[model samples]
Target: MAELSENSSGYGGMKQVFTISLALFIIFLDGSIVNIALPSIIKEYSTDLGMASWIINAYVITVAVFLVFMGKIGDMLGRAKFYNIGLVMFMLSSFFCALSTNVEMLILFRFFQGISGAIVIPTSMGLVRTAVPPEKVGSAMGVWGAVGGLAIAIGPALGGVITEVSDWRWMFYINLPVITIALFLNKRIFQHLREKTQPLHFDVWGTITLSVTLFVLIYTVTKGPDVGWMSWPIIGGFTFSILGVGVFYWIEHKISYPLVDFELFTNKLYVVGLISNLLGGILLAGMMMILPILLTEAMEFTSLQAAYFITPLSAAMLITAPVTGRLIDRFGFFVPMIIGYIISVIGFYLLTSLELNTPTLSILWRIGVIGVGIAMIAVTSLTVSTVSVQSSQSSVASGIFAMVRNVGGAIGVSLFVSVIMTSFNHFSMVSIQDSIQQIHSTSLSTYEKSKLTDALKAQQVSFFDRNYTSHLESLEISKNNLGEWKKMISDLRDQEQKNKVTAIHYAFIFGMLLSIFFSISAMFLLKKSFRL
Candidate 1:
């Protein structure tokens, strides 16, 4: 394939850049918007945490599995052709997602949506690199990258307004107009771009071996709290996931065309950059997971309110990341990464103040600081990953970076939800036990005390034994005194609400721990620009 020098078609080079950037923005915007809207979906569907999590995990895990596979297909086939297919597939899936009646259906469609996303990401980048001259490639990519960062920054707020102002379905629907415009421009822009098909070997065993393992593993982790961790379902998922990963590593090493070459881990920069990538996923996914719970469940903010409150963080990132990226070109990686992570750590520490009455302003600056920190880390780490390898192997860097980031996101969201739910359940049980003990010690008559104890036992036992809330109405108590038990039920509900507050607090802490670890690791990254 000949390089597309500074050749001008009907649309100039910048128009092509705009089309690709819009596509990137469309994908990233959906990712953040969905996070803001998740709590509504959970409340509306009456689904449990594990079930609701699949709304996120299903898309991320599927994307992670398909990214490299699709990238290879892009190389073997036509890049622009697959990219257009991705656009159509994503639009259709988005429409179907709006039509979903159940959580399962929504998640199923989102999985398809992710496959479309996997196709678009690498192809879009490849297309941009082809259309722009070598000197201008970085500038075009910067614009492409900036749109993504901006989308991430504003998605929460935008999704909130969409959910609050209209319906959550509108978030998916919103993409149609944007995609329509991008597709219209991209058709002409992509025409001038040439596809260089390569003779590539398919890593069949490696792809299957790994995808199955990750799916099972993530499924297990997400459901561990809902189903007992030790239950056959959970245990089986972990068993297979673990065994699958082990097999995947072996298969990749043995195959001629490995999915992930173990040999790359030998490079110091690659190793460090990977750590940052995985942590980046955990940070993004974990914060998105817990913040909704905080805003909607604990702080009693509407989706829109939470989105507005969090906008500053993204704004800070939008403003700072580009400048930080420039710093990586001048001062090298070490200073920027260290400064970024340090601010992020401070931001996380401030977030420990997340309680029912915590003011919105406190959250804004704290999260903003963390965002500023990430701005520095995100660009620097990408630079590090690409620089760690030969220029020829830069595509490998992109693949590995996407793989870790998505896989880590899937794991992070699952882990955060599991930890939060597990923590909340523990708190709920303890509160329940204390209430029962208080009842036992009350100076009521013997028969009265006995009746209350038995009734409480029946209620708790019924609640745990059955899956539905209808079980609460079926408790064994005097039918005549049903109204009298209303006070007790109210008390239980209050206790449950308090337990939720505590759970969200702990989830924030868990997220902070991830940020702190990532910040610390950023200190050791090579203090140099990428060779490319």
Candidate 2:
């Protein structure tokens, strides 16, 4: 392999950056685009919330677990070879995902799609480091980050329009064209830049232990609500996960070439950057997952309307990312990260005030605040992870950073969904029980009281079993009881809506607390005098 010049500059260098950035852009775009389509997917499959969530979780977990290993492979063999291969695999997986007829099939394909993404993301970052001169690496990273932000900006709206006019399947099909362009550009730019290959021992056991740890941990969190939280399976899953983590750590410490380099942990700057990235992912993914559901279910907005409302979050990110990159280059990551955290905390605080009747503009501005805050943290954290390491280790560092972020996203989606569902069920059941007690105190015949009580009791399981209104409509009521039944159903519906709003409000509160913790951690971890 020829040495890359420190003064490397020309059309070729710019083209290389653009090509790598475009590849990453699509990877991020895919993640955001699916949130808008989740409701439609659930309806089509008639799946419950737990099952519907797997559509996101399965992909995220697969990517998070495989990223480090794939990144190491790219370093050992050739990044360009794997990068191009990943593009092709991603395209094929997208096609299969579109063709899937069942939720199970879709999840399986999404898992494959995630594997391809793991290959592409780290390699793209590695390629960027190779393409640019050392002095201009920050600027090149700025362009990369900006493009990723742009992808997120358009993803929801694009998905909404596709799902509205065509089918949700079209969203998957749409990837084909974009990926084709990436493949073409990849071939043109990376052909001569391939690094010489070397044979190395792969850390297969370390990979397995780490994957098992994450999968079990995430699975337990996601399924705890459905099966009783104290059930044997959940208990066993947690025990296994804890043990797996210990084993994985031991294995990594013993290995010469570990999946994750433990040496990176010694770098305070790198560690803080990772912590910021993890927290950012949790907030960002949680917000994206819940907002669409809130809009469509609680506020009665169409998918397109919800997408339009959520656009500001990513739009703010797109606008802020480039500037954040430059700010990191000049003032270092500490200033931008601290400011970003404070802003995000405020955004989440405002989100806790959300009501069923909150106006669209109000929601827009709140999420927009979050977008700016997260963008600063996200861009800064990524730059820190890559540049803090030796250029030779850029791929591995990139992989570790991405792995933490995606793991946070998987956990966030699982945790938020569990919280909202459990809270909604608790609130709804209490309201129903109170309503039953009120009816019992009224002057009514024994038969009438018995009938009404049974109807309300049926609704105790309504949150998980079936639609509340549909279950009510299936009940038999006498002519004399029709008016009472209608009033009772209407009131229950109102209570259900209130319960959803309250549940979502609690999730925001959780996000706000996380932001505050992230802010405090950054302050303690990075000294006031430290820069970069």
Candidate 3:
């Protein structure tokens, strides 16, 4: 512990904080960057969307499942040692990911990359907690949150730029240089850190049951929409997850050296912080997934242009996170947290008003407002969760915080996607039915009416596939009703656009409800007058 305390002052402390943050930036960056490049990867490998999606899903599931296990391992062995080892593994995995010849290979390497990230994340927070003085912990956490927020927010933009300028593989190739610099700094800064010198007993069954439980739960959520939610496979997955969780807690209660110490949950502040963190994760992840789709699919912006439009989100978060941390350090977590939720609720309400003709500045400002609120909530919750526990337990606490947030994010993405698609389908069908009746009332020949009806049906089937023109051209309508055909097509296009806007509006309404719930939870659960 002396080695940890000795570096708690002056330039060395700041260097250590930044070094840990640098590694975290890359880990968090990878989580979103690959999403923007998924289409490119799909084209190159000649794979379907379902298969290409695993390139991202595999990494997320792997990270969420292994985070706590790796954190406990770091506690038993040494934080610095595992952190450095993870950096090396990350670099090597990035190399292999970039060099992969097929989608399967890329997914496999991404799983390895996820494992490396799991090893680094919790341990990095633990290192910061132990290395920084107690008073400055909030500020340190703020910096950590800021860097991570900026990385995740900007990842899509950077990926779009890379994919446009060079190739998707460069997304992975770029990690090498960043990791090299982090490794150099890590070795120089923590050279004197020593490992724990005690006999260790690993919790084999607990690890197994917990891992199985998480893997099944997340896998089920990720695939539920693709495969029907009530399908046999999904039902079985839910059943297995429930049983596995029961077994895991039973094992943990009986074990001498459990993977996760149940005592952490006994702390009221910690539990409240986690709940708030989970809600915040749901909002942030869902918005990140949907906003890009809205820009590209509805607004008809290119990927690069969409990325540029969303830049204010990252910028707002980067600027707000550090300041939020300092506020927590001075005034406490509760005030900043409540204020954050209020701002977020306002932002979500603004999002619900988005229209087809909404100006670019309106969209940018709405996103920026949400970003600021998210940054505040995120930094404050994380800082509280970290500071509420004993120093010895910081690594595991960090792991649990991270795992909950990831699970919430997964749920958010799944939920938002389901709502949006279902709503879109319903609205599209209504529009098509109305158009069909209108076509029936027109005084055209029976044959032309039948042709137009068939075209409407075809358009409904392939609405989201973005093949409207091709589908219409394939119908081979007679030139006699060409004017009516063009008019009908134009009306259908306008209705399609409206359906899209209505679907997104409904999604944001859901988001607003979530934001309100988040606010209510923070107000009731958190102490009104507490300070770090």
Local accuracy of candidate 2 as per-residue lDDT tens digits, 1-532? 1122233343247678888887788787877778678879999999976787778777777888788888888877677788888889999999999999999999999999999999998888878867765556666676777777667667888888988889999878988998999898877786555366667768889989988888888777667767867899999999999999889889999988787778888887778878888987787778887888788787778778888888888789888887887777677767887888888888888888888888778888988998888888788777777777876677778888888888787667777877788888889889889878877886656887798788778764443332666677666777776777677778878888888888888888888888887777677545655554
**lDDT score, residue 156, model 2?**
84
Cα lDDT, model 3, residue 51 = 94
TM match of model 2 to true structure = 0.88
Candidate 1 — which pairs collide? none
lDDT of each: 0.70, 0.79, 0.84
Sliding window of 10 residues with minimal summed lDDT for model 1: 460-469
lDDT at position 139, candidate 3: 87
Candidate 2 residue pairs in backbone clash? none
> Each model's TM-score, in the order given?
0.80, 0.88, 0.95
Estimate candidate 1's RMSD in Å.
5.2
Which candidate leads in lDDT? 3
How many clashes does the backbone of model 3 have? 0
**If ranked by TM-score, best first, what sequence of candidates would result?**
3, 2, 1
Please, what's the RMSD in Å of model 3? 2.2
Candidate 1 residue 251 Cα shift, in angstroms, is 3.1
